[model samples]
Target: MVQKVVIIGAGPAGLLLAHYLLRRCNYNIDIYERRRDPRLTDISSDRTFPISLQKRGRKAIQAIAGLEEAIAAQSVFCEGTILYGKKGKLRQIPRQNPVLTIDRNRLVSILLKHLNETSSPNQVKVHFNCECTAVDGTAKTVTLHPKEGDSFTADYDLLVGADGARSQVREYLAHNAGFTCSQNYVPDAYKSVFLSRLNPSAGVELEPNKIHVYNLNNQARMLMVPQPGDQLHGVIIFGAENNPLEGLSTKEEVHTFCQEKFPIFGQLMSLEEAEALLKRPVARVLTVRCDRFHEGDSMLLIGDAAHAVSPSIGQGCNSSLEDVLILGQLLEQYGDDWDQVLPKFSEQRVPDAHALRELSDYTFPRQKFLVVEFFLRTMVKRLFHRWFPDWVKPFVFDLVLDTDLPYSQVLSLSQGWINKVKRSST
Candidate 1:
């Protein structure tokens, strides 16, 4: 008998899981998404930022064979990051390995296209603009409100919620089932930003192989990554309660502000981009910390729906993709028995998720003094570790970005500094 699987949200986690499951011919999967079909819409309409995938996230996509190559064709690999300051001072931070970066929507489009090319409608179905509104665990059914039709209920032998931080399936498990969950808005919010890679008259251009950042202050910053066609795409992140772009009514005003605060990017910014910036919605990030990821044998949550963390460290998407990888492993280990796989996944992933929150929140120091020390420590650690590899570990940020070491181990090694960061903020 074929097991029917229903996955909510066609985001990275959901779509990737579909690929993983479809490889095993016994499962039929259906994915529901609230947004319009990404391939049919303009990329900018999606309001997505660039996602940097390291080994942890890459390994997941590589398992499917050819998926990683497809994504790499559309991605930009950066070997380092450049920090821009208000006074035009620049600091370059280099990474040992190049990280693959791609706009989130572009990544999704590639995934969806590959998913279609590989899987048939009989095996897997992706429904867009269909929102899941409720889950009935005992009935083994989910109710979805589609854009063109009346609400409907579909039954599933197994239900997986990869819907993300604001997940409806997770809500059902917590409020109706016995799952305990909590959600909080992170201190920062962001608006999508775009810039050209060149300015002919000014003769200014950003490095094509680097992630560029401009810190407006302690309250706001812009982080942009180079795209394939002489474009820069990223976000203007700011304190959620304090919007730096407040009171700016015109496109020229927004343009002037960027030119003054981030002169280089400002020179590259176009009037059209400035207009988009003025009208784009500000999106706040919500972090989800759940006591458990699964409720009984029939239902489970993965990715942001399981453990959404702050993008402060760029691990939200990485960890989300990693969740699919972890679950795929457990499925193989348990011989496709979800009853055994669910509990083991919770036992293995819950601690790592909790530890990830700690790592994400404190990996970068918040204070001016500690921020300075952060650079010093990272440089000294890199040099020291080269001389005596066994005695010293790389910096926490390095471990999180550059390696696939478990988050639990990384937290254990960096807890002292993490504690200090939390304390200073308090």
Candidate 2:
């Protein structure tokens, strides 16, 4: 009998899982998403930011033949980052391995497109503008409410929640399955920002293969990643309580603000983009931590639904995709027995999730003194690791970004620095 698998939230996690499950040939998949289809909409800039996928996330996509190629076709890769300080003080940090970057909606759209093209309707059906309202584990059913239709119930052999940080499925698990979960909004809030990568008349062009980061004082920053077609897609991240654009009411005011704060990017910004910036919604970053990722054999949580962290370290989406990769391995190992896969996945992944929380929170020093020390240490480690590959360990940032080393081991190796940053902050 073919197993009916219902996945909640058609983001990258859910959609990617559909791809994995489709290959099994014994699972029929249905993915429900709350938002309108990305292919049918142009509002991604308001809600989605550019995502940088490193080795771990990239490898997961690479495992599925042709998946990475499709994504990379629309993506721009950066071999390094350019940090902009006051008065255009620039610092270039190079990487041996390039980071694959794409807008979030573009990534999801690519995944959905590939799924539709490659899988039959009998194998996978994706429904957008619908959301999971309730889960009845005892009944083996899930209730879904669509935007323009009546609520419906669907039976499933298994339920997977890839519904993002504010997941309704996770809510169900917490209330009924004794799952422990906590969510706290990180202090930062952000709005999508768009700009041309070049300003030809002024002879200024941001590097096409570099991540551009500019600190607009201590409380606000703009992090832009290059996109195809001379586009820069990113976010203006600021303190949620202390909005950097508090006095900015109109497009001109917002433009002037950017001009004063991040002059290099401001030079490339357009009046139209400033207007969009003023109209865009400010989204808060919510970090979620769960004690375990699975309830019973029938219900499991993956991706942001399981572990959400601050984007400071660029691991949120990477780790989310990795969740599916790990689950697929578990399914293979357990001989397709979900009962065996469920508990073991939690056992193997829960610790790594918790460890990721610590790393995401404290990996980057916020204090000025520690920030200098952080760079100095990174520089030293880079040099030492090159000279004595076996004797010196790579820095946590490099270990996390450049390699596919298990996060738990990365945490163990880098715990001392994490602790000091935590101590200093408190």
Candidate 3:
């Protein structure tokens, strides 16, 4: 019998899963995306600047097809991250494969091309502009709302829900299939703006191979990622108890806020110009997690849908892509045994998912302001950087950046070692 799989969302996870399954297992697959085909036109005008893809995310893309070169062409290799401490001290943490920054649109374009070339040109399909209105895990069926004003239904042997934060698949599994789930939205807000050079020939301001971060130490955090040539993309994230951007109505108010809080803005952007451009509202950063990632024999959720981490650690995209690779491996091991594989994938991934959830929540306060806490943290970080080897920083960074490690196992081993060190100190 020919088995069929229905994947929700056309993001990295969903698209990669489709390709891997098609390559290894002959599962008839269909990808349903709510947005229009991004390749046909520019659909990211409303979106913030492009997201950064880490080594892990790059690795996942490589697994599907020999796309490393294609993706590398558009990406700027980030050499190291610049961390600004409380007293205006700048520390550069270097890495071997520094995170690579790529335009979100360009990466998707490459993935779409791979999908087109790899998929069954005649039979396999990618349903663009088709919204997943409903899903039934018990019946193993999905209903999609087409752009043409029609509803269509499809049955599947398996359903992979990579639909993102507010996932309809998750809702269906919890409400209809008796699965336990929880979602937490953090209090951080983010806004992105483009900083372009007036003279096209002026040349790039910073090295193309670095992820630039200007940490104001709780005043306001700013990150600038260099694009292809002279253009730079900047994002500002701040705490918002009641949506911090709500009251900043006019260009003057926005300008005042930027000038008062973000000193780096003046360096890279004209205050008046930035305020005028960002008269719109800021974007909210939400963290979502589910206690259980699967239901019975038919359904499972991955990526932001199952575990949406805050971008403070910059692991959201990397972790989402990792979910694809891990889940793909599991399916290969337990092929056709949906009854056994669904439960095992959930159990295997739950620990790491929970660890990432707590880490995402933990990073919020580092960005939040508090005088005593800030000073204490700065002292601790300084000590760590002084005594620890260059390799240790990224390992600590990995505790958040990489979520494939079993969270509980890592924590247990870490704690045991910490206890042994304490005993020797006494």
**Candidate 1 — which pairs collide?**
none
| Candidate 3 whole-model C-alpha lDDT, 0 to 1 | 0.68
Model 3, 305: alpha-carbon shift in Å? Answer: 0.7
Which ranges in model 3 have alpha carbons more than 4 Å from their true place? Answer: 83-91, 197-204, 217-219, 242-263, 270-280, 363-395, 398-404, 413-426
In order, candidate lDDTs are: 0.91, 0.91, 0.68
lDDT of 2 by residue, 232-332 (tens): 99999999999888778999999888888899999998889899889888899899999999877889999999999999999999999998899989989
lDDT of 3 at 36: 76
lDDT of 1 by residue, 1-426 (tens): 799999999999999999999887899999999999999998998879999999899999999989999999988999999998867899999988899999999999999999999989999999999999989999999999999989999999999999989999999988988788999999999999978888989999789999999887788888999998988999999998899798899999999998887787889888899999999999989999999998788999999999999998889889989988999999899989999999999999899999999998998988899999888988999989889989999988888988888899989998888998999988
**Model 2 residue 356 lDDT score:** 89
Per model, state how many residue pairs clash: 0, 0, 0
Show pairs that collide, candidate 2. Answer: none
